[model samples]
Target chain A: MIEALKQRLSEHFQLTNLTIKNAGLAFLWVEKHELEMLLRQLRDFEGYTHLSFIIASDHIEKNQFKLTYMLHNYDTKHDLGVHVDISRVNASMHSIHPLWAQAWTYQRELKEMYGIDFPESPRVDEDFCLEGWDDMPPMRRDFDTVKYCEEHFDDRDGRATEENRQTMKVNIYPERGE
Target chain B: MNLTHDFSPTPEVDLASGKYVKIWHGPQHPGITGNMSLELTLCGDEIVNCKTHVGYLHRGFEKLMERRTYIQNFPLVCRIAVPEPTFNEYLYSAGIEDLAGIEVPELAKWLRCLNLELMRLGSFLMWLGGASGAFGMSTVYQWTVTHRDYILDLFEEMTGARIYHMYISPGGVRAPLPDGFKDRCLMVMKKVEKLLYEVETTVLNNAVFKKRAIGLGVISSDMVDAYGVTGPNQRAAGYARDTRKDSPYLVYEQLDFDVITATGSDAFDRTIVRYQEMHQCVSLIRQMLDRMPTDGAFHTPTPNVLHWKIPAGETYVKAECTRGEYGYYIETDGSEYVRRVHIRGPSYTHAIAVMEKLVIGANIADVAGLMVSLHTYPPEIER
Candidate 1:
């Protein structure tokens, strides 16, 4: 299947760069990165019609975020999981929604969740969450969810106690710890 | 090049003239069975182009699963596919059990099958309603909804919650066979089977339904394979791809039933296939209740869900949901929290790829009709 897919990728797609890095029976992850020229060539390309998912993973350990486009060429039974690694500090990439309309939502979702900006995408400004007063984008590598929970969410450690509740009263209440 | 759909490119390439108005149908539309939208570019009553936009319903379930412990996600997993929640909890517990090397007792497996099949019937009844409503048959909607509420009541009696019954846990069920629960479930299921037959007379065999659904969303066998369509949608296209039949996790292998398949791969075929499968579910439920095993554990032993370390490994569990193959691909890094939980559902492919291919060249009037005919649960898609 890998050989067939690799041959089909060369025959069907004029890629600026492509490589097969991982292979396993459970799953195979083929890394492919394309420049602007190959991006236009891929538009007219057939067999790569179905798009499974587009995800931007915040690899905190690697200190870089990876944006992956999992495209399925149903015609050839070939799955090309294209990934582009970018620095966490400037997590931005060229959007592919111009080639496929379905990327519009997934790109918008990646931006909303990870604070990654899409430079050349359409409709990326759609609001998924963080309606106003923005803090760190939630899916960022440095978002610190536990800290965010402590600050934004209710830290109900011994929260249901009567004295703690009484001291927590808004008006005419004395400070106390339970 | 891959247009096995057999529709030739328009001789005059209407070219999706910019005059066509693009209408975003949902993410919220009453006509839509769930919170998903189709970007429909329509030229009068004809559809020139169509695209599906989901992810509005994303609850960050995979991300949220990373935060919560396995047990806490039971209540949350119920929200994955609200119409059918038991399967989500069932698969989660099953996956965890498989990882921990905990084998569910034979009785528990059969009981799980009983619950899954009954839920299938209940959920399919809901689908029958929405599928018919797509063609302006409001009565089927009312009929199926009224019938399904009784099943929910049975669920409430068996477990505590009406909708989100987090009854099935990692270690057997949350509670053992409630007194007379089996009889109550059987009675409701028998009544449901009767209502299902009435649905057959009024909706399934109804001529208007045929006109609305038949050949409306004709997905080819090749399209089904290419797009990874599974469950009823795949079966509807004459592919016998039910996980319950193929993998037979739980008690499905023990139970005796034939996999239902439809010939046309069209909207009508999908509806009829689900209708027939509901009958089979009724039979399977009866078989399970008839051979009631009142003696073994319903769940495996589980530790404190929070701070409970799960054994490091990956487990993938799939079941024949009312829609299609409902699966969860989970990865555990030996932590209490999941490393990654890829929630795969039937709607992921059905509402996205298959619908995208089917909607184009179909009449604009038939767009919503085609969607409801597919019977995709939107929350599952977002998950």
Candidate 2:
């Protein structure tokens, strides 16, 4: 079922790196400019009406952020994930709020967590979850969470930290050691 | 049926003119299911604009999962949604299994299904209590919560914990069903079935519940896809889009049950849909108990935990959570730790965008009932 859809979609649009994970799931890469039109076609014409989720994975080594828009076709019970790679420097992508009202929330979250810009999304600038989060976008691969915790918070006195549980257990009970 | 109120422009309220008052609805209120607030702009007891506020319970489980190994993340995922933790445990394990190419055993499959069905029954009972309590029926709250405790007792026997049962591990389940557990489970099912009847008589048939819930928070069928609504919320809106029926996972394909739905698309309709699903849960449990394979291996062995490295791949695994379509999108990097893990809870949209739109033009008193009727958990949204 997904093979025929991919064949029909590749005929018109430029689809690259198609990965058929299973019979009911597939992911394909498309240009950022082609995402909106492709999603609109899928939602309206291809029976992929439900926008399951939109998530971003930061590929810092490649200086790119991969944004996946998971679309579900209720009629066929298949999931088609549309992946779009945008540059990591001043990342921005075309917003799909016009296609799905819930896209704005995902866009807003991507903006706050990964510092990706979605221009003209409703309330995109406002805080979604992290209020008064003045530091770096916490989700970026560059942000070191452990360092931030050590710098901002105080550790409790007499707190024991163990790096390895097996070694600590052996040290505590040498008679019962294996 | 007229949904013009949802699309109509919001009337601006000027606080300087003293015509409207702004209030925070929750974070520490009994009406809210968890620790989250709604910033409401009200004009004489009618809410004009509603903006949902979360992050009070945001522990950044997604970011935390990046540093933890595959086995370490098993316990952490259950904390994402307090009410329904088995969905997280199952989906997390299922996503890992999908990417790692690990097929679970037959007996494990039926056990996982039984665990999930029990979780659904327990979570829905809690929600039923909250929904009734929001509507000023405290008696139903007491009755349902006590019965919910009966379900919790079953969880305690099965998984050794009441709330966060990290029993559904990656390769397979943690253990087999205990001895003599079948008859004990059937006993609790009988008690819960009796409780549902009492609830139906006292809460569903009550005048106050119908008066407050029938026409409140109507979600048009058109909004189900656009706003990403699912589970009972979308089912109540006249669409029978259930993950269990559409894409059957685990033992759902073997189970015989119909997708429950309602046509009104209102609070009362959603309650009826879920209430019927509880009876469906009872039947599903009975079917699994009768059909499950006896005396077989319950778990599949995996690689060593500390040095395990999954081959690089990505997969999104979802399940029919009591709330809606709960999922986990996992991307592996062929290393000891995961690259990216995004937990998609149904409340992420139902609480924010849909709640913001539904609460507009609603009375102040019905806001809690409206929110509860949507059946959202706040930790899942912020996570």
Candidate 3:
């Protein structure tokens, strides 16, 4: 199945990298410029009809955001992950909502959560998974969730702090000496 | 059926202007199953457009899982899907085990299957009540919920809690089966199976239910492929796309079962599809009880969860959740904390994309019924 996918993708574009992560799971790192064409072939010609999900992971150390478009085929029950690296400074990608209607919801979520831009998505400008507030996209790696929680919400009064909690863990389940 | 009707509210212009009145249909009403709203634009009794609004139940679970240790994530993921909580736990545990290179024991595999099947039965019972009640059959709700509590009693005995069972964990299950647990579970399941006949007569065979659900919210196989509608919704459309059958997870490959499908592809067909699945769950549990080894290792040993660390890797584990496919894409950075955890719940597509398309041109009275038939749990969508 992996060989078949590789042969099929090679027909459309130059296959730069194809890594088989696990049995029935494979990943292809495509150029950010060729993502739309790659996904179009995967959906149309490669029998990858189901757009399972779209998720972005912020790799701040490399100054890149990894966007994965996960697709599944109904006949073979195989999964393929198409990974694209976008510049963290200006994260923008073409929307595949025209290919999969479900992409509208996922693209809207990515736009709101990671502040990524999908230029042509329907309802991409509307509020998604969050409400009216002016703040940084919370899912980014540098969003400082603990600090935001402390400022916005009140903590429980009787809970132990981090240091005390570590001590309590040792006291409760002491390690056994062999 | 009359598609247009007179409203008591005064109209500002004649019918030629193409003006429609908008109404908020949810966020508080019993017609909605969860904390979600649908903004419906209605011309008389026919709906012209609908926009779904969620995020009322968003708890930022994805971020919270990243902050907490892998062990602490067990309970949090279960809360993502309220009705059938064990599927979330199962996927998270399986994903972490895959990343950390932990092999689940054979006895634990059967135990986990038992737990998942029981959860499916419980969720279908709740759906039976909600689907019937949507069409003004309140008695079926009373009957089905009462029988569902028996399953909850079994859950309370096996795991300490009824709704959220933090029993399934990374290495294996949290604890072994209690003494005589199988017998007690079988007893409850038998009683539930007997009562299913009554449910069939009251809900599936009821004339009113048939009239209300026969052709409502009809979904085609083409629509299922395009929008990714799954589980009972797709099965009712005559496509046997079950994850258990397609990608055999756990001991499901070893066990014998059948995929239930119907031909109607309408609201009534979906109801009947789930109504028939209860029998499969019962027989599957019976097979588990007979085939499982009595005195075998139930859980694998692991490092203390508080200090456990997974190696740097990423894996996706999926299972047949009650609603549809439940998947977890877990990544670890070789640290005590998880790097990323993205949940691809079935409701994400069922609630937003499929519901948006199905709601347009539907009668206002059948809108709630259509939503109920899709079985979209809202928290999974917003989370």
Candidate 4:
């Protein structure tokens, strides 16, 4: 099934970075310029109709964010993940909500969490999953959760803090000195 | 893509001669399921527009999981979906197992199936109570909740907890089944089946329920595809899409059962589909108990929970959960901690996008009932 999909996809579009990572699973690094065309062909021609999900992973080391669009083709019973890397400085991508209405929620979430801009998407600017949030995007790699919790919320009197966990780990495993 | 749904936002129209009354439906109301609010624009008794507001129960599970190790996240994952927690555990474990190349024992697979079917039965019982109770049928609600407690008793015996049973671990189940567990499970199934019959006769067959629910909240077939609605809600609309049958996972491939569906495509039909689905779960559990091996290892050994590291890879595992297609997208960076974990719950779509679209033309009184029919778990949507 993976080979058949690869063949079908290669026949019409370029397969520059296609890799079959696992059986019944394939990964393709889609270029930012060809995202719209690739998604349209996948939905229209390749029969991958179900837009399972769209998620963004922060890759701070690589200085880029990886956005994976997970899709499943009911006809072929195959799962595919289309990965696209966008710059962290000015994250922007075209909206595919026109292709699938469910994409509205995903794009809205991405906009809120990663500060990614989707040009021309309807209602993508509206707040989702967060209300009155004005800090850094909480899902980003740089958002320090421990510090945020410490500053914004009160701490219990008897609970362990970050320093306490580190001290306990060092005490338990003395051979691996910190 | 279908390309039939209007993706554009609803235009600002002058209703009530530019005097439309806007009201908040929930956040604290008996009609609501959880901590979520719906902004409803009402002109007289008709609803003009509805906007769903979530995040009341959001804990940022995705962000939190990235900071914790694989095992530390196990107990936290189940909290994503409070009503049906095992499905989250199953999907998370399945994804980690796939990424780490952990081979599960056959006995473990069968045990997982048994636990999964039990979770489905328990969740549907809760749904039965809520769906009928939305229409003021408190008798059905009380009976189903009382029976659901029996299933919770079975869970407590197995996992030492009732709501969040952290029994489903990475390589397999956390513990072996206790002695006489099968007999107790079978006895409970018999009781649940009898109670289900009474529920059908009293609530489902009543003429008043039919009058209120049969034609209300009808999900058109085209809308199911356009909005990505799944689980019993989509099946109630005559769509034969199910992850268990389509993409067979766990021991579901070896089980024998039919995907229950209905043609009415409305609240009543969706309720009936869930009703029949509970019966199907009973039969599946019976088959699993009869065929499961009597003596074998229930779990595969793994590394220490605090320091285990998975290779660098990404995998997406999905399960046909009680509510819908529950998917977990996992990415590891060859470290003791996870790089990212994205949870795609069906309620994220059904509760927000689809509910907003369906509630526009519905009557004000039917809004809560319609939301109930969709089986939207608020925590799943926010998390």
Q: Pick the candidate with the highest TM-score.
A: 2
* Among all candidates shown, the one with the greatest DockQ: 4
For model 1, give the interface RMSD: 9.3
The global C-alpha lDDT for each of the candidates, from Candidate 1 onward, is: 0.70, 0.90, 0.85, 0.86
lDDT minimum window of 10 residues, candidate 3 chain B: B1-10
Query: Which numbered prediction scores highest in lDDT against the true structure?
Result: 2
Worst window of 10 by summed lDDT in candidate 4 chain B: B1-10
Candidate 3 colliding pairs, count: 0
Which portions of model 2 show Cα errors greater than 4 Å? A164-178, B1-9
Model 4 deviation from native, Cα RMSD in Å: 2.2
Query: Which docking band does candidate 1 fall into?
Result: incorrect
lDDT of each residue in B324-373, candidate 4, tens digit only:
88999889999988899988888889988888887887888888788899
For every candidate, C-alpha RMSD to the true structure in Å: 7.8, 2.5, 4.7, 2.2
- Which regions in candidate 1 have their CA more than 4 angstroms from the true location? A1-59, A62-137, A145-178, B1-19
Error of 1 at A9 (Å): 17
Best-to-worst order by lDDT is: 2, 4, 3, 1
- By TM-score, the better pick of 1 and 3 is 3
Model 2 agreement with the true structure over A15-102: per-residue lDDT tens digits: 9889999988999999999999998889878999888899999999999999999999998999988999999999999988888988
Task: Report the alpha-carbon TM-score of model 2 versus the true structure.
Answer: 0.96
Error of 3 at A65 (Å): 0.9
Candidate 2 on B62-180: residue-level lDDT in tens?
Answer: 99999888877889999888888999999999999999899999999999999999999999999999999999987888888898898888888889999999999998898888899
